[model samples]
Target chain A: MNRDAPCQDEWSILVVEDHPATRQFMKLRLRKAGYRVMAAGDGREALEILKHHFCPLVITDWMMPEMDGLDLCRAIRQESWEGYVYIILITAKDSQEDIVRGLEAGADDYLSKPVHPAELLARLQTGRRILELERTLKERNQEIARLSITDPLTGIYNRRYLNDTLTVEVRRALRYKRPLGLLLCDLDHFKRINDTYGHNVGDLVLKEFAGWLQGSIRGGIDWLARYGGEEFVLVLPETDLAGSFDLAERLRRLVAEKVIATPAGDITITASFGIASFTPGGPENHPAPETLLNEADQFMYQAKKSGRNRVVGPTGNQ
Target chain B: MDIENTARNLGIGRDELLEVLEIFLEASVADLEALTEAVAAEDRSRAGAAAHSLKGAALNLGLTEVADLARTLEMAAKDGVLLGAEGQLKDLREKLQDLTQAIQA
Candidate 1:
């Protein structure tokens, strides 16, 4: 099958029938319609093909040798596969009881053979359209997932993403006995900067600082976020105090460089950061995540108290 | 919440945090002192590291303003760029000294 084409990649149709002649005819018709066709002589072979291949559309004869179409249809329904599998029961048996049993066996729809090519084509088209819609929905879902994690303003991770991902990182740090560092950073007197200078200048300063942070940061695994307001965050997995301190200083220095351009004029801004690391500082020995955050908050305030545009954490010397 | 319980939840006792803050303050003074001397001597790395250490100490205590000042000094030193704002550094140091005293209190 030439699956190189986008339309043909998932365009496989499985045909199962006991009678070889009729099966061959159906195969010819489906192939003509640009469908890749795989046929099984009976139910058993059909099961093997289904197992090996992801056949999203299946057509089977209602009565066949050994395991009939009804049993095969039931089996397909029971097994879990992501793609939608359309089963059409081809039978000369058109009684209401027979149709009920076929439907009960999970035949998506029924067809009485001497199969009508036009009807079969219409049904297959419907299945194809449904699958196409499903594919579009799946892609949209993935795009939404990507957007949810990103902060629109700074093009960094958003706080919601940080909180969820960090909870997992926190547990992993505890389990693996590796250190994780959290840097909680906020602009010093940011509210004043915004209130006095107006939001435009405040926004320009934020963008400029974010650009600096984006440059100094290395590695894909390091997660950065604008926590909220003037606050921003970084989660350094597998980073001890030593590593985090180095990065934090780099970040602090980068933010302190100079004035960011704004419509009003060039205005200088500074930030303060509080750093905390996994220091056997679990609930028992020290405190929980919130408590640790509080400590870091206090430390950041201390940084503000001492001077702005600084990084602080547990002393690496200790 | 009961006032006492709420206070406790707020970590009002300040035992471990205080100890941690005290160590940080000690480190801060030493760092600021080093930074002051280094700036006077035009020793960039020494000045930067000193400012950097105080910055870290300030961060631990949630002193944003002080940390920002120290960070500014640290960055200038890191770039081998001496800040023209010499007076700013002096003012920051005095403020940091005041913070060390406040943390003690």
Candidate 2:
């Protein structure tokens, strides 16, 4: 809300008037008010300026050669733009009918000619407030979207996000004929640890593990998510079976070596991993995501059955 | 006529007031010349446009006499009635020249 900052104060206004003297007067007045100003002789000139420079505020005279203020306002409203443009029309037509005409032509506000300096500036302040409100609303909407996709407890992406993004990744891999890898990891004897250490300490351990897995994965290229209670899913794009195995081994070693400092004290933990990869159009190509996940889930149970802390894949325990 | 009061009401300093007055004088003279030519050629639309433009500048600068006369001429042209338009234009022209000289002084 503090528009005194440079970024917030950089809103520019365009003034379009065929009369050079009036154009200069408006430009100087607006510039004095700490607004960046651009001027054009008529609507055509204003459109030319708009093609390259994005001016969010426009003040135009009603009558001019070639194109008038109403024509300019209509043209602006027709085009699609990233930011909203606020337009004010200044004209000698002071009747109620004239005001209605201007508003219908897409002018946000109207001013009679012989414009009072104070009144003009006040209208512009209103325009600034509206633009600021729009900016704040857009930012808040984006934050809400991000919050919906993230896990509240672990601060990692939630299962809902994993479900949506994994399908898109699989389709992309198929299109490019690249391999897509999925790693399913479950904490070893997690329920027993929770019963021994209490739920608070158990929660701390889960949070710590999530942070560690997020840090260990490749930034931007790989993503990890909290699949459910004690299970997590890692998505590795463009990775083959060999690459998945190397990553699984590295993750297993990292988990075995790391110690989590909780309120109860230092606790070392290990997790079992199951890595499954889908090579596009291979002899055993996975036709659906559910089947691929079932294969990984089966392999993960195999790892748990063989021992507690190890990785198992299609070839068996490794 | 109340030039200082007009400047104070506009919230502009004396230098800005002088600059605005100077600009209005120059633009109004050219517009009045165009109005004269349009009237002589019996081009009512051009005459109306020129008169309307002059009226706008005069009102902004607080040239009430010039603005009133220009407005009358503009309305006459718009109505397609040349009657009394020449008289109104002559008076508007005289007021503009006098105002220009006063500003220069």
Candidate 3:
């Protein structure tokens, strides 16, 4: 009846007490407290149960029929399971030596025996609270990790996250020897827009352009990010240069034609793109990761120089 | 006419507020020209369209006091009653002009 029980929809608790009377009493108590209870008389049975289902909390008694609770705690800790299990050890063996031994064997907390209903409830309460706190921390950590990688303005992944993740992706591509294409794109005449219309209008144009990109891109493996101001990158997994070029041309034409309805009437904007992929014995063969970035970046500049609003790729030239 | 004061009254930045007001100003001048020509020619629909456009812009900028008069003029002009409608239209025009001028200042 403790508040920590959380209405017992999902959370399971395992009671590993050897004596029939003790095990039965604990089973009754845990079921009443809204836990899906699994009874194990020994460490081996508990280990078998754990191999199949993950119990976030485990309550064990020190002395058991075969393979004692200390051994069980040790075996559980050594497993490959990434999640935490709050192990509360109950025992009539209340000596300091035995209690310390239980904790050293990886029991999270210890409960003394003649376990009063109130004391037992309190221990389970602690177990539930600790599990909930840990779950919240894990979720918050993921959210913070997600935010750290995202661009503040465009709401796309930033350069830091790109560098961190792309390197791993590249290494993975190399390990499996798969094709990975990178597209570098820059907004045309962005400086002119900023100078001519003011920064606010420039910001509006960028947001509109980003919206256009978001509307067009829809693939599970596509990795999109704001590479820098007026620049964006898309990493296409298992994609070759030809596919990347087709996508780039579509995006280029889309941007060129998309009319932004600003307060100053509809403003038309265009972008230049550069595509590069891992090609065997090509112009950028055996190039470093930065070299690929540099090659893509250079080609983007070439698009800018050779007249904007087009997609350019490595033509096997330096 | 001060559009900046209109913007301030609407809780938008003075510059953005000014730009929207200028848009309304440009729209209003064209509408006014059409309304005057429509009234002279006894064209109710044209007068109504001009008044309707002006009313919408004024209401968007939270100029309810100005919008109410414009709406009255718009309805009267729709029913082919341009006589007293001109009086209220002139008053609404004065208010917009004053507001735009204050905004510019």
Candidate 4:
């Protein structure tokens, strides 16, 4: 895939040098090259700037008052940052031992001073290339993480995500003595629709149903997940049985009324909803995630038996 | 010093080189004072640090005479010998004055 061209203005290079004239010269040259520049008098000041602003590239002088370039490299490596910092240590010391010491202290590259502006810019371009590679890899890893927890068809949370998070929600609710509600829903006669209108139409109808339910729920407070084919689970925190029952009833009617349009034809479908809730002082023993799921599953089975397209709660069918 | 050639070699315009030279002149004066005090007190580390700072800035601006003198002074201070440091400091003052006049012209 073609990516957007990298903008030079977005690449900020931090210059750490104790000499005022040299610092000014570096800032001037880097700014002329279209890069954003930040300057510090010494390594200590550089650390202070880094605390507030993120700079991926650093050009430092080896010998400085208070903290030197080597110490700065070590300190930066010790602290965990959101992204990698590429350091280029600029020094007049050209000995082999000094180069090895600089690298050992975490300098990605080294430059001998007096640093020609052309050479400095070239080295920084190298640093930017590496930083760009790191950024792309990090973004791809995050995308993979997101895909692992997302359902491919409906673009909602998958069963694996539900299993992992539901346990955490249960622990949190119990620890905080807060009420939690779980709803298990199944599309009524989903397989029959697949048989009558082909699986393509059935898939479209399922997508429509999932989208409708996802839009109707509280975004961050409540979450909906596809438990399996034609079955979904909604976990609601800080919600009691009565609240969940009302929501399930409302959703039952909405699903029954929605007409889903597909390439084959338009189809109307209804869903059966079952809700189970945990109150702080309830008499239910050991309200684990499995117990809640089983209770909701039982109520959903009851709703399916009672002619379908209805909502069932712990109290009774509605 | 060939100001135009130095500016071109450093990848900057002559005007920008002049601006940096002005800053260099001001900073080197301070470094010179610090070096003077360090030589009077026979403080080897302070004298070496002062000379090192001067050498770095002068070298960046392509002031060869100033940089060479400052490097010599730095080496002497580092080795804990201030024998010729006073004369070198005087010569460094004269070189900086000559640079200021050249830039002004």
DockQ of each: 0.00, 0.37, 0.00, 0.52
Clashing pairs in 2: none
TM-score of chain A of each: 0.80, 0.91, 0.87, 0.96
Q: Compared with the true structure, what per-residue lDDT tens digits does model 1 show for residues A1-318? A: 212112455489999975543455556556756788999978889988988987889999866668889889988888887777888887756899999999999988898744556567778777788878888998899989989998887788887897788788777777776677888888888888789888878877777777777666666867778888788777788887778888888777667776677887777777888888785564434335675566667778778777777877767211
Return the TM-score for chain B, candidate 4: 0.95
* B15-98: candidate 3 lDDT, tens digit per residue: 655565666666677777887787777688888867765665455455677668877878887676787666776787787687
How does residue A62 of candidate 2 score in lDDT?
A: 92
Model 4, C-alpha of A292: deviation from truth (Å): 1.2
True contacts kept of each: 0.00, 0.33, 0.00, 0.63
TM-score of chain B of each: 0.71, 0.89, 0.81, 0.95
Which candidate leads the pack in DockQ?
4
Which stretch of 10 consecutive residues in model 3 chain A shows the poorest summed lDDT? Answer: A1-10
Q: TM-score for the second chain in candidate 3?
A: 0.81
Residue A27 lDDT (model 2)? 75
Put the candidates in lDDT order, highest first.
4, 2, 3, 1
Q: RMSD in angstroms, all models? A: 43.0, 3.4, 36.5, 3.1
User: DockQ for model 4?
Assistant: 0.52
* Candidate 3 residue runs with Cα over 4 Å from true position: A1-10, A173-176, A192-201, A214-218, A261-266, A316-318, B1-105
How many angstroms is residue A264 displaced in model 4 relative to the true structure, after the best TM-score fit?
A: 1.6
